[model samples]
Target chain A: MSSEVRRIRYSPPWGDASIIGVAGSSGSGKTSLALAIVASLNLPWVVIMSMDSFYKPLNAEQSAIAFRNEYDFDSPEAIDFDILVDRLRDIKQGRVAEIPIYSFEKHNRIEKTTSIYSPHVLILEGIFALHDQRVLDLLDLKIFAEADADLCLSRRLVRDVKERGRDIEGCIKQWFGYVKPNFYKYVSPQREIADVIIPRGIENTVAISMVSGQIQKTLAHKSAQHQEQLQRLGKIAEDAPLSPNAIILPQTNQVKGIHTLLMDPKTSTEEYIFYFDRLVTLLVEKAVDFLPSHPEQVITPAGNVYMGLKTSVGTSAVVILRGGSAFETGLRRTIPDCRTGRILIQTNYRTGEPELHYRALPKNIAEDGLVLLLDPQMSSGGAALMAVRVLVDHGVPEDRIVFVTYLAGPVGVNRVLSVFPEVRVVVARMGDDMEERWVESRYLGC
Target chain B: MTDNTAPSQSVGPEYLPIGRKPTATVSTNLAHDNVTILPQTSQLIALLTMIRDKNTGRADFIFHSNRIIRLLVEEGLNHLPVVEHTITTPVGRTYSGVKFEGKICGVSIMRAGESMEQALRECCRSVRIGKILIQRDEETSKPKLYYDKLPEDIAERWVLLLDPMLATGGSALMAVEVLKSRGVPEDHILFLNLIASPEGAKNFAERFPKVRVVTAFVDMGLDEKNYIVPGLGDFGDRFYTM
Candidate 1:
């Protein structure tokens, strides 16, 4: 029934990743400036992406000059802005992106690429960060790190001769010939468009706080929007009948008996655990009926051949951590060797919005015949939608996935089904949408 | 095998059967080669007394009986085999240890046996459980298989055979036969129960020496009606219905 219900389009908080571009002359403390901003924000999702990693691989002729420190590394032409812009666009939309690892010593791009996913804010630090028009379009905040010209030259001299294995002459030669000229022609012009300019870079606390405050405000705005979106979706799902995709266990005497024990206030902890786990087993068992099977035959001890649809294959599970951990026993009981993965989505206590904290999925999950998303309780279905979005982004087909939970509200189930109409949900019981999650705390004993 | 000459195995690495799977609130009494009865400790006896009383309600019977059932299941896991394992500690020194190493499933005799399913699932997570229903032939007074549903890979897993009361060894014996016919080795099955008649324990042990038996209590013997003397009445009726 949820399929015919109004659907709400959703994008995770990470989907609209904010981009901050930091540009400066070589040795002008741009790296320090970005780090200071990160320290002020005090967030894990804020990432610092170096523009040096996107440097164009030099030809043999240019490489020889670079070896002599005679090549122009400071010029915007040397930075591969195309790949940089593509990576920025990917982060802006919360897609997994591979960043090239360029080797300065070898003057070539390494074969390996570091993967980045779900970054909420990226600090693109390089001389050309604000130089490219495509990159400028993606920037949410622009910062130009400034330092004295003589100071920058001296810092470059100390940095190169001591750390980069360059001689004093080569350092000075590159500083005057390439770095000095590039700052005037290409780098200085970016300062005109910068939202904030930091003089003395990391030492300028006033500027750092101002920039961090603006970013924090932006995050608060996004979080408020996310919570509003969830409430809107919940309202749409409030009265809709459960979709056929939600396969609750047949309410037989056995299932009802377990439910009574679970709901009773006087049930002992041991019995509560036993019956809950038993109920979980039955729920997962019902979930198997949703899995596709092929006909196969087995010979009984009586030497008679009987055809069976399937013994189970190619099925894996993704546990939405903590609450989902409660489903492990039930999952293990049903599929003893079933491969498992984990995704941690926690609610913001103040904002009432769910945030994706961490995720580690099994290899080639998209290829699995079926994937079960396990969580013991659902009220708002905010986390469910995000969890489903995570799986969909990872290449698992929506139709091949199932969200399994022990207790859920109609609105939560309807909301998830409305967005992912193809994906089914298996819940043991329907309870109040406002009911708090106590099953996991009781089961985990924490 | 009943003497636990074989080591215990778990899902992780397994070395030697360091000791029997710990029985937190119960201790071993008989220690026979194939049978283990919970010793009459003050703790064990008190729990037994509550369930044995005829006036005891279903709620108390279930609560007390489950305590012993948990112990029986742990004792059942004790008979599996284990392999030697070594690991490096955080202090950067090697520590020789052992871990469990095998898959396990439960087979519950339907009706009464079904009561023990939760306990099995409690001790073992996501444990695949099969159901077997047996009824006595009124004329022959013999156990007969009425229905059964089991895991497809039963032959390869360590089986925990669950039945609350063992009397006359009739149902337990027939249950083992059903498992063995399905290719599960006699040694791989561990019969777990809350109470047993001495006659029942003896008959079961003599029949299947390889299948280990773990019970919480062993009463004196069976009466003419085949009911265990001083035993809790019709366990299924008391536990399921009021």
Candidate 2:
């Protein structure tokens, strides 16, 4: 049998300055194709930057036109290409950038945003990504995912109807009058610059696979470079003495006593319960001492009340459900009827990301109070760091969080501290020598 | 035989709650070995047969699950080292063997986890079993906790954590997190499951080496969903009689 001619899949840049531009007309499946490539290559460091996220905030005039479907959305000027260029540059340099949120319905940028931090493979996709000279210069590899004009228009029509909540009349008018001409003038011209063209976009699984294979090679190259840089950073972090920011709980005789009680094999269940309750009380007490407090006074039963300052325990309540709920005993015993909220961070093994299963926090978690993040064990500290980051991103001050865990390994503690050094952490005991793994192996003596 | 290096135990009753003033007495020396992890003959027989049978329905699947849970829980409780106690009999004579030190609670990882609750309650009287719902992602097959409600002072009680199936061990691990976050000491928790896969059990053991897993049967493999191979179909679906 004669060998088939293999397509040349576009390769991402090897060095740090390289950018990968995903460009195609609307509904060409550029985003879908990019995602497949990113995943197949296990390119966790890659950031998929949607050009839609950089859409300019609509001015009042444009807002009115947007409402009336008279705005020129398909034009390159509609996007904030300058900001997109800056973000791509920042990410390439290993700097974090706040990626804008694009609201499809209001047809403008949203107030909320997601930050892209230190991504190596920047999958910059949008209709106009390849149109701008500044962006084009930065891109090491250019891709054009193409589809038939009729097919693109039909797909866009359906997407707008289902996701964008647009009527067929508006979609047809927008596509025929504005989008059609813009594609020919702006998006189609970029085809000459593309190192690789994906025909039929996502439908051509073979093409996607080839591109993905290239991405893997690119990631492997970049990973070696990154690992070297990481080694340098680790040496730097090691040479620099532990920051005062890491507040270690005092390892005292009482602490060792408790640890001994916990570690003891012959300790009766009754003794176990007693020591555990006592230890938890102490741990909670110590954790509260770390909470931000302000001076306040309380009246006594006698005529004269004691003049003592109360800790400025922010008005926000504690929130822990699922595993978090177990702390209520100590919290109630110490804080006495403290208001509480719940957030469910469940792991979906398939995705390996802790999905927010449920969230019912107080209306003003960010504004009102200091949050005491309580958990029993922290191995990887991924969930804890993410939870704390979520609160901070939503406006909670870094200093307002007091994280307490019953047991913490060195790796998880280091991970949490490295990410959020400002947050106070207290653990009854620290297992300094440990490695965190997700899969559990059982004993099946052969 | 198993590794029998029991954790050190404190002699007297010591009660302290971290971050809070003491409320009730807490005896801390609850050794991990206190929870007996025995190989159950009947449950293993059931598990092997169920996994072997191609035509096993939801009902039979659930029955086997309950059977496995009951035997595992029994084994776990047997390992709970008890203190000697004596009470006056009608004949004015006293006798003593052993008595549990404190309250016990069952925290079930939801859905399939809830299936283990009955077996736990049957073994421990007035046991408070909490619920933590961790759903697996359709794409990743990882366990994600969707909802959870737990006891006030889980740290003070002996917690029997029940989840019928542990595949990749993601859900079980996260369930441990929920407990840890709530201040349950690593040794305070006992993870019980009807079936486990080698990959999952190995991963979990490496992360929390001190914690123990008492499983009825260790399956040989995991499918894409991380479901135990030759494993009965989704325990949650089957246990719910879906």
Candidate 3:
């Protein structure tokens, strides 16, 4: 295995989230500009991560200053750039990042946090969105929303009075004392680095459309790379022998009997469903048997000590939907109380690329002792690879995952294992790598 | 069980065409304990008519049958217990409501039984499903369990036993026995089907008095072929082959 080693990884369309920094003076419509771009794109994956969420908690003196409307919140020093940059980097690398929630009314950070993951485009909008060098390095597009100074102050007065409950005098006090001055000292300088300067903010339809177009283009390019990477891995997998981690159930008569019935086209749908389900249950049991366990003594009903073993960690499963739906019966059979998460990765008809349509994973799946990726069959392993990548991205360790399938071609098995050598593959039988997926439809009957 | 749990709608009996009601022909079968036949409504009758007609094409058959199956599943869900739940509204007010008290899963009898699986899925998100195959032993010529894949925690969940047709009731009885062996309470199991013969209904309710049977239509009786008359012929064959 060590003699011919090659490492490859599949990157989803949102793998490297394009960070777009929207910086401008307070009340200049930075948020509105981000919203406009998102509205034009009309995509669910374009997330607007407000830099306001990263506002640093204030000490007693600073809190008092903030209460008096004398705090320089518009300045770069007032924002926690270190934490902001750390999270931005995590998003850029397609990893989970917890963003702190700040309360402007309380002038402090809240105890709870919100998380960001798998965003196709993240609009980092705030007065100092582009001030940090580290942030500038991660940003793919830099936008500066501009408006007249008088207009900015008036918008601030209306917003503070209605939403923040600020008195008119204090709003004016902060406008001149901190916000106005900070715009010149720290916020205004960011415009020099901005790629697009849109005056009148959201009213600039041409600018918003341009920004949205660029983002769509970037996404299309990333999707192309993902498809190419999958094919590259497949080519490597095609020539290699099955990974040692790919474990096939022993060819017992029971296993063979089930497979024979399943492979026979003349078999009635009733018998096909029966045998396929039987095979799936056996596959799940085989996967469970592979989980690490420790032996202990327990008192039996006969008043005698019995030696038994228990798995060291709680196991959860992620069902790759549609096809994975076929495994629901078997999965319940093996672990009736098992927590299950679902990920739907559908192969695009036009491109033969597996695109992730939806995912709802169990909480803290990365911490699970074992995570089984359930799919009834694997041919080219396109969906399986994407599904595994999802779990790994969500924090599940590669080694802790076991790809459970009723039938898998050698190419598909090798493809998944070659990319994730540590992960184990539990299969019932092996056949044509390019075989059309018929079992999920056969079993699901839809 | 009485009709108290039946969900009422503004679309009333006035809409049902005369002499075309689900309850009309199945009154005799309803005398069996723990059996609930779907209420008579023109919408349901129309769907049954499309499926039962021999001239109905495959696409029409599947589409109409699925609609009826969806209704059967919704009715089946009414039997599940619910607990009062209080939730706060976004307007800073709280309202009391009810939520399902326990988890539920579907256990489909293979082939024809799998037809109901999709309907159950449409009603419940990520609901776990199990499968049981009880076919004749061939040698002994008796219904024997070939395989059963039940959830590990089935004993704790209300099991929706799915099979499209109920005729002779041998396979269903064997399936119920399998559930009992797995520690599932008889009352917790709801046998959901599209149609059932009178003989099968009587035989099933008598064998397991606690397991409720919820069917869309109860046909007159079984024919010599042991198939439900006026019932869509060979549910598994029609469902899969079509």
Candidate 4:
């Protein structure tokens, strides 16, 4: 959510930003090690997420107990793990996440939130950083800072007294009764889960440098792979071949008339909307014919048996936001009973890759007889590909998905077909010229 | 009525031969009028292609099969009884609508039938479900009922019997018998399948004239081994990797 955090505009199918989790007992220098790694790596984009920020807000009774130093902060129950897992997933998907700020003095979460954008590297540091299995699975690397119990206790004693305004006796009593016991019971066991254990915490310069070096190497390799993938995608778009699975509408006079109206630069927005609706309606009508039907025997008004075609099953439509939304009216006009679903996909201005922002599909979409994926235009096919991926992930068959778009460039169409060969692509027009306008728009930053 | 005598054959579970080449041709006498073969739409054809392709992975096979099954279920729902109801629209106009009349229950013929359970549940939230496991004896290929579990009020509900394939109609006939024994009227039952052969469809209709048959495709006649020709191999093996 922080505008300062660089938004990764591009996402290769294979590479993702690395996440390193640093876990240790309190005062074991977990935060220090996290800071050193970010500084040593010299990465332009890095984020340090302190697990303390995820503490569950305490109620009046709990706050009173915490004020009296009777509450155990180190317990795993003290954290809002559900929110932590959600934030971790959001970050992994290259989305901004709002992290809560905890007030140790009040023993509750403060009103404000820190907006964090996806970072090149994320370091999660806290006592339970490696505690939850779901959180552990998301971590690319886990480091447990190990220090002598006596040393940890001594450090906690000094820090709490100086910074937290705690008396020497209260700090010592809490350390032994609450902190030390929880450290052994909960924190120390996580050492087994760590990929690397650093002894003496940040003072161990050798261990710190080694960990930072490994991160640097991984980042370099991933970025290189990402660059190669981008090149491959560009090449695929350049050598765009007509996919055998694509259905291109014939350039009939009626179709041509609408195309001219849409293509004309001087056309009014109202006229464009009208023609676009007509064009989409025509496309959707044709696409519905592709849905299964059965022969039905009906008694006609003349008292004769009539054989007619009846739709076999229910159909659903999922429209990509904005451009794809233009086809919703057409879809309804064609199949009034069809349920509609919406998916919002936006191109990260910086990454130039489509990122899913919101999705609200009808319940039982998985059981829909057929799904029509609507996107009005396709130049790079990034959004279409992402939309198809979402559908497939939701258990919709690749073949059951029919992508209905008004205009499709060979590059985008081929890119989609290459990954999902069985998916049916229906377009009003498919030609080399489709990319021209898109390219000009990109150049103008439109 | 056809002869009710059961074939005398017993075979172990592991010895059950699936996708076996037929050794002797069997005659089929199904009434085509009682069966409905859905028209092959482009989307249906594409889905079938993915399902029939030998190289399709298990995950993909199941995914496509589920989609096809949902369509089949929707088609079956059209036959259910409905009553007209009136409602006021947002524009302040009264609109007459139809709603399903009776309670619905899904009775799956395990284990291939289990694949369609998710689709049926998605269609109707309050629908009850039952299961019947009827495995074929390896030697006779006759369906033998081993387990049957039905809801208490199944007699009053419209039952949708789910099975992915109708190769010989032996299991389907047996499933219908099981439902009939539970007091469910033959007219109240709808048999849904992904694919069925002409011979299998004929056998099922002959056995239960009142039970409706809905399937995606009616393939060519069954072979000597009773497997539907141009069939997509053994559905259970492909779907469950058994």
Clashes of each: 17, 84, 2, 7
Residue A350 displacement (Å), model 3: 2.5
Task: Give the alpha carbon lDDT tens digit for every residue of A1-446 in model 2.
Answer: 00121211111122264578989999998888888777767644566888988889897888888877778899998988889888787667544467889887887778787876535567888888789999888897899999888888888998989998888998888988899999988889999999998988777889878877776677666645533433343343444444344445555444444455454445555555445554555566555544433322233211222222233344344454455554666565445656677766654476334434455556567775467777655655556665665566456787677777766666566555555666666777655323332101100101
**What is the C-alpha local distance difference test score of each model?**
0.78, 0.62, 0.78, 0.72
Question: Which segments of model 4 are wrong by more than 4 Å?
Answer: A1-17, A25-126, A131-138, A143-179, A185-227, A233-241, A293-313, A336-340, A348-352, A355-360, A433-446, B1-242
DockQ of 1: 0.02
* Tens digits of per-residue lDDT for model 1, B1-242: 02211111111001112242221212224446899775433335445655665666887778767766865775677567655455542223343444456788999998999888877766676899999999999989888999999999999998999999888888889999999999999999999988777778878988899989988876555666777655677889888985
Q: Residues B1-242, candidate 2: write the lDDT tens digits.
A: 12212221111101212333212111112224422333322214423344334355666656555645665775565444455544432223333324456667889887778877776664454688898988778888666779989999888877888887777888888989999999888877778876666677778777887677787655545656445554556667666855
Please give, as one word, the docking class of candidate 4: incorrect
lDDT, model 2: 0.62
Off by over 4 Å in 2: A1-20, A35-50, A53-69, A81-124, A132-141, A161-170, A192-195, A214-257, A265-277, A297-302, A313-329, A335-403, A408-424, A430-432, A435-446, B1-242
Q: Per-residue CA lDDT of candidate 3, range A422-441, in tens?
A: 77889988766777778777
Worst 10 residues of 1 chain B by lDDT: B7-16
Scoring each candidate complex against the real one, what DockQ results? Answer: 0.02, 0.01, 0.01, 0.02
Writing each residue's lDDT as its tens digit, candidate 4 over A1-446 gives 11222222335332255789999999898988889888887754577899989999999998888888888777999899999999888777655567999887787888988866536578999999999999998999999998888888888888888887788988887888888889879999999989999988778889989998998787666656654554466566567557666888755544555555565444456666665766676677557655654433343222222223344577899988866767776676446567889988776567565556667777667777679998877877777877887677567877678899887778788777666776778899764423533311211224
In the predicted model 4, the residue pairs found to clash are: A1-A116, A2-A115, A9-A350, A9-A351, A10-A351, B22-B225, B30-B202
lDDT of 3 at B169: 90
